[model samples]
Target chain A: MIPLSDVTPSALNNVTTQFILLHMARANKEPGLGAATCLALVADETAAVHFQFWGSECDSFRPGDIIRLTNGIFSYSGNRNALVLRAGKRGRIEKVGEFTMNYVETPNISEIKWVPEGASGRYVPESVVSPYSRIFPPLR
Target chain B: MAENLLRPQPYLAENPLERTLRESFDTNRRILDPPFPLSIPTPEEYLCLTRAILYSILTEGRTRGIRLKYLHAIVVDGYASFTALTASVVDELFERLLDDAKEQIVWIAGEMVEVGAQGFGDLLVSLLRQVVGGDYGDGNMWLCFEEASLFLRKWSALLEEDGEGRSALCCGFYCFLRLLGDHCRTRWSGDERLSALRQLEIDFCTKMLKEQFSLCMNVGRDLIRMLQDLVHVPEFHEIWKDLVLNPGAFGCPLFSDISQIYRIRTPSRYFLLRLTPEMERQMRFLLTNLKLGGQKRHQAWFWNKFLGTNPERETLVIDLIRFVCCAHHPTKEVLHSDIIPRWAVIGWLLKCCRKNYVEANAKLALFYDWLFFDERVDKVMNIEPALLLMVCSLPQYVAITDSLLEFLLLLVDNYDVDRMALITRGVLTSFDVLTRSGVVPSSDALTSAEGISPPLKERLGALLLRKEDHSAEAHAID
Candidate 1:
């Protein structure tokens, strides 16, 4: 369990955190995976991130749901062309609560660019792309 | 197959309480019936049996009889933890409960009452809270009917036992009295079941007021507020006459005048009887967590989820108003922080009202405390928000300021003509304490607000300028 701000682009299914879903886009089908995927803006008290929901996860969550992600991966996906947070093959997400958790929309970690550090292959935030999600804007 | 206690939603983790009960039931499945083990189990096994029994009773409809028998056989702690766990299920999972599961919960509540289980009163109160005040949907109305029937059926069982039973009866009286105001005045009165439910509620409330007047008095002045709405009903009309014209008829010597009811501040818990736990949670979250400017989204969510889809829900605004004013008092840190104040949330709720009656009732709820405020007993917090709301809405939303001030004045003059002086004194003291405590800088802001109409200002000015005649006023009321 960690704050969303601590998550960096990673291939390993190790990021564990909780966030409230702020905004969600309509689900789209991925031909290769034969499953539906939805893009959503999720946040915690610390920071916001772009969360990708795969398969039934798309229909299982909605705006205002507080979700807990276990062993999630935060890395760039070529299809979305963005650094997104997701429950990869080895990870899972569950709806924990709703409407009570505090959240921030700014400092979207997914919008920040990341670069791999020397030989360690660990990624670090390189430069800012946007302070908030470009795909799903903040509520007025 | 047994039904799931709560409606299954995708990707949601299992609730630990349900898991405990389910696992226990699974572990004890073969032994749940007949030929009970002759051995007295350890404390841990006792708890496991209780959980298993509760789970079986809730989910296993066919074997409910046998499961209840098992529960009775292993009773310890006066069924305290068992009833409390049932209440948690009601409070937490009720909204998602399948229809059959809901029926089972109500049936078990009746069983709990029959035996006078230790915490059955609280279980009944929790069920009562789940019956939304203004909801007219079939499910909501069905709950209303079932709970009303249960209260009527279990009236004696509720009264025969200890203090918890009596207090739970008080809670029922408060809830049904308030609910009857809705049930009697709705479009669904044409429906037979709703009509039957209305009659049951009226029967229970009228019986409480007529046969058990002393217990009804324990609910305080809000009793009159709820009763006033039902004056059109013939039964309550007779009760009202006795309340006002013949106080002796109630048979309580101390409660001779209605002012006595007015003087005793309605305890905060009575206000909570009207709101669902889910609604209470969202309101508390908005007031305690969100900042003033950022509340729009949460308010939108609250509105859409609770108030948006139905016109009848507009009436819930009144309950929300009273709940916010009487029930949820913020701490100094939350109050001092950028967190939204109670008045702001109230102001938004006022604007949410789509119907005239709802708006008026909401305003009355907001100012009901001010009509009978006693600094000795009533916290200034209750009256503080109305004046602050009036002051804050000035200049730009001048109409809000004007209407609220006009309503306050109207209430002083006509809320109860016979008790005008009491109400006037209450209003004056409310404004006085609000300013004196620096909740607002001065009363001049309201009295001198340019947007306020002239005649209304004069009435307010006259009321403010009137000298204190404590002895004379007390004599007049007495």
Candidate 2:
């Protein structure tokens, strides 16, 4: 698994990694969908990012589960309207361990306000809107 | 420009956590109006953003001045409209777009339809279909009947117009009412959420029909057509049963008679063809109650007078005409439905054509069902012009009857006859058509007026001569 710090905004394709979910918020329904989704904060010792869980995924994983993601996407999802690392269609995730790894939960990738402007005209984090998940208020 | 100075620029810096909280705080303060000057989603930029919209999506302050509150409305409208022709690339971004679209789509549609914007009208129609189609769950679809009724009231002129737009609206209204009836009739348990959803939709359906129907004449007519169409559906029969059997379930749809001959249209023949036994039973119940004799009080509040002096009584009869006509045009539907008794329609025609007497009607107003009894109903150029216009606009079958002759002759008794000006332009045209069509005898047109007072004889006699002269001119010209 890649170190969470290496999973940068520049990492666009084939972002596979493993992390412990430090905390998760409740599932929410966005405007169009008939189903609810959840947004949470996950971390590895080196860095942290926001993660979205859809359908059964919401219930399958919990705050302490150390999960593995294969071919996952780190992009915008749900009402949070921010980038989140998620097990998108080509991606598969399974619980490999629980609370055994060191992790950090700051600078949620979802909190970063991304805009399409770079030297290459690709999505770049123009500003960081928040350092943590708003829904899953940072565990004090 | 001064207001821009006050809006915090927390979004510009690389601090996502502070920005998210601040956005929520902004939303809560109700300071959500989109400051458009700052809002911009560049097409080439939006195209790039459209693919993922995840990392590319902007936060509250980031997306070129788009306010989430209004964006919510835009989204609801988009959700409701089946006709939203989306570009192929815009697909993936919708889930991302949902955050912005999270509000009710109520008023936007009425405004859109009013402005005659095509895409928005489809949204309103879709919103209607969503509720009626039961495509929503968990009370999420708050079918604002008030808005839907307002939609008809607001967009009617355009909806009634002839074109692709008109046809789409026609189909929209047709499907909407039919689906609404089905929605109301469906069974649901009284769980708080489900019950509220059911009740709101039902209330909207009832109000569109009852309270607000008469707000505009064309809207009222269109609503009637929808209800008539609704009753024909087996699934919709319950709403029909409610209207025809439960007096309270129905409302007086006619508020004014300014609806000239121009307003009447050929009503659907569907209900007429299949007037089932159950339908026949309910219509009879409606007719029996509609008879003005028994229903003088519950139908009105401030005005308690019966058909003679009561505004409610008069309005009830007028609404009764519209209500039944909604089932089918009064003339043709009468052949099937008992809701409109022939005698009552004739009685109404005569009542409408009541001759006006200025001094008599004014003085008679004070005695209005009080200690005194008086109804010197007549036309003195102070005619019951509402009744006159209504009488003139009836189906040609009703307008050409011998009963109409009796209605007009009732005015011949008072010979201060002002034969020069008609109450309205259409009234004169209708009268001329009736005369030329032989419904009114051409020869000695006022022969019966010879024995009236001198002024009456002179005026009536001159009108008779003018009619003959006009007939001669018609042959010479046309």
Candidate 3:
């Protein structure tokens, strides 16, 4: 399995990684379809990214649950400009273990201020937003 | 549209962006890479930094020249918007970004056109979507309405002058209009919902004319075509005044070809969901913009002052015979049922609609014909024949001076004599009431009766009791 840090926004790379959920935001209802979604900062040893859980997935996963994302995607959500990492339509995720994986929170990949022009002429990070999400605070 | 998949990036390298950004920021930096890659910035800082970059462009792009390569690098980097910016800042930020983009198109000699598009195209659209979708400060409906009004005014100004034969800028402006339109169309909703913003924008835009914004010849054309999909303007020609009276403003004039004029289809009946509330408000806003009172102005100026009677009480009653009412727009059924309770009689009957009588944009006439004759009506909406009789029986249904009667005669001529007989039987169901109703003209008026078909006149004559038999006509009929 590759580290989350290796998954860049150059193209849609089929990602399969195991990460422990550090925190999860409340399941918010979306606008059009009103589907529920939960946002949480998930991490493995190398780096971290915000993982979004949709519908039943939002309720099934919780903080400290080690989960394996199979064929997940990293991309920007339409309408709302937030970049996200999720198990897209063709992807799947399931609980693999308990809170056993080592992780870090300071580099929530989603919190970086990505300039439009990055080092590789892709959306590279510019600065830290915060060590964690302001909307969904990390579980103390 | 899934724009990211098909789009091509600009040719600028990454190093120039870091350098140019440092200059724009006036800071010493080896590189401008994020402290952590792809991290979302604080909403406040993102807004601050974005505002600063816009300032540099609007200022520098105006005085010095466009930093084309620098701008290209920024767009190529790809925007990582992990959060939706609040509504409060969207309008301000969008105005600056669009204004700067507008200037970059004009003063930069077209080199920055792609930069303006690639950079702000998605970003500004996302921002505008946020603004239009969110509340204007305190959630005041009027404030929302006014903001929408102002936005329509602003976007309408984004015109490209093929003045110098600069196709690049024209094409870029066209893309912007297209992108903005895609985001704003087809969300049917009440005023309280975000979808109503699309309707408000549609209504506000219909009020602007191309003549006012001389540079908006291309942009205005795009806007109207965009609007044509939102609301059905039955009289598209009336708006343009035949292009003869108002020349050259249209890039593609409304109803250019005779066939195109006939090609009009109203926005699907999904529009009817909010029509009852929206229609009044839209009409008022449009009339008020023209410095006229709402329903009162039409009643006073045309009917009272000149027509020698009140038009408020008069209605150009459309007898939609067989039932072409939309399954989606069931509200018309409510209005139809209320015909007898609301008023004594829908005093003026507009003759049945015909194709040749009305101009090319005869969609209303066409709709009436399709409603009566179309086979689809039987499948969906079953219009009762009793309602037609009640409408025919209204006390003041026929008046000598009503201009609408002229069109009804033409309908019988166009369709067939039998159709008129059907309409006459429906209207004059009871022979006793037929004597008081002079729907059919006197025989002496025959010289002018060519417009009315013979079968229709004969049907009307059958309903009419002769003056000699008038005393016993009711008894004889019974």
Candidate 4:
């Protein structure tokens, strides 16, 4: 398990973390695939991220729900052109608690631009696309 | 593969308490037969059996008789562990339980009360906390009915059962009196079930007040506040007359005057009687942890969950303010930090009131301590928020400051005509201590603010000046 701030852009589906759901967007259905997905803003004490909910997950959680993701992944989506945190096929998510955790909206991991370091091929922050989430602004 | 105890929400982790009970039941299912082991079990084995039996009582409806029989036979610790587990289940799993499980819990409570189990009072208090203040829904009303019936049926047992006997009823007394304030409202008088429940609550409250006046007195000043709401009800009207006119009617020797009730500050625990556990948790988190500007989302979530469902729930704002002002006190660190202060939350709650009466009641709850505040008895924190709210709201919201000051002045005169002097002294002392103690820098924020209306200022000045004249006379005499 790791804090949300430690999550980096990775395809290997091994990010385990917990956060409170802050804002959720409307569910959208694919034109041909008929699969539904919703984007949500979730944050732990350290940082915030854009979390994509697939299928049944879209309606299962609401704002103020504290969710724990097991073996989750943080990577860019092919269609949306934005990075997101998700529990894709080999991962899981569960509601653990609610309304008790602290959070920070700045340093949204999803909005940062990551670049591959020299030959080690590890992702590192190259530039800031935005300080906080552009899609879901912080609640004043 | 086994029967579950709680209704499973998607993506929600199973509560460990429920999980342990379910596991105990499953692991011991085959052995729960006629030839129950005759040997006395070890303490650990005793806990396991108790957990399994409780789980079966809630879930295995067909074999509940056998489970109860086994439980009665093996009771060595005064049913302490069993009742503790039952209380925990009620606290943690009551809202998420299946409908049958909910019924089973109430029935089990009846069993606990029937047998005079240890710690049964806490179980009853936990159940009472689940009775929401402004809720008029069928499920909420049903719990009210069942719990009220349980109290009425076992009244004698509750009075004489154990060491926890009277105190538990005291909790029930506080709960029902507070609840009756909502139940007796006219808008919901048409509902048959609510009407029945209201009658039962009146019967129980009147029985306690008439038969056990001292016990009712244990609930302190909030009892007056609760009964004040019920003055229009015929039965409570008679009680009110006795309270105001004939203090001897109550028959409690220590109770001489109504001011005695006013003098005792309502304990913080009694203030918690109205809030559900979840609401209490969220409010505590918001006040203790969240910063000023960052509380918007949390506040929205709280309102959406607790208040958005019913218009009647706006009535709960009054109780929430009382809980915040009296029950929850922040430490000096959080108080001095940028954490959202209690007064801001009260100010927000004051704004949330949609009805005029509720708004008035919320403000009254905010400043109830001020009317009867005695520095020797009452903690300064209880009166701190109203003063800070008045001072803090001066810059951006002069209306909040204006209305609060006006309300304080009005309450001093109108709250109790006969005891106007006492009420005046209470308000005067509240302002003096808050300033002298440095809770606020000075009263100048209110008295000398340019934005405040002159008429309200004149009244405030007169009230404060009157106190000084008396003090000066004492000095001159000395």
TM-scores, all models, native as reference:
0.95, 0.26, 0.24, 0.97
On the 0 to 100 scale, the lDDT of residue B327 in model 1 is 92
Best TM-score goes to which candidate?
Answer: 4
In order, the TM-score of chain B in each prediction is: 0.97, 0.27, 0.27, 0.96
Task: Compose the digit string of candidate 3's lDDT tens values, residues B238-298.
Answer: 5445333444444454434222221232222212211222222322232222211112222
Which model is ahead, 1 or 2, in terms of TM-score? Answer: 1
User: What is candidate 3's DockQ?
Assistant: 0.01
Candidate 1: residue pairs that collide: none
Per residue, candidate 2 scores C-alpha lDDT tens digits across B44-108 of: 43322222121112232253224333433333233222124221111212212233221223434
Model 3, position B329: C-alpha lDDT score: 24
Which regions of candidate 3 deviate over 4 angstroms? Answer: A1-140, B1-266, B269-281, B284-294, B297-478
CA shift of B380, model 2, Å:
64
Worst 10 residues of 1 chain B by lDDT: B467-476
lDDT (tens digit, per residue) of candidate 3 on A23-117: 77888988884678887778877777888888878877656567888888877765445768888888888776543355655566777777658
CA lDDT of each prediction against the hidden true structure: 0.86, 0.42, 0.39, 0.88
- Give lDDT tens digits, candidate 1, residues B1-478: 3346778888998888777778888887778888888788788998888878888877877788888888888887888988998899889888887787788889999999999899998999899989987788889889988988898898888889768878988899999998888887888878898888888889889889877888888898899888998999998998898888999988776778888998878889888888888889989999999988876767777887889878888889988998898899999999899999998899999999888877888899999999987788899988888988899898578899999999988898899999888887788778878888999998889778898898888888788887367436755655
By summed lDDT, the worst window of 10 consecutive residues in model 4 chain B runs over B469-478
List model 3's recovered fraction of native interface contacts, to 2 decimals.
0.00
lDDT accuracy of residue B147 in candidate 1 = 89
Q: Among all windows of ten consecutive residues in candidate 4 chain A, which has the lowest summed lDDT? A: A29-38
Clashing pairs in 4: none
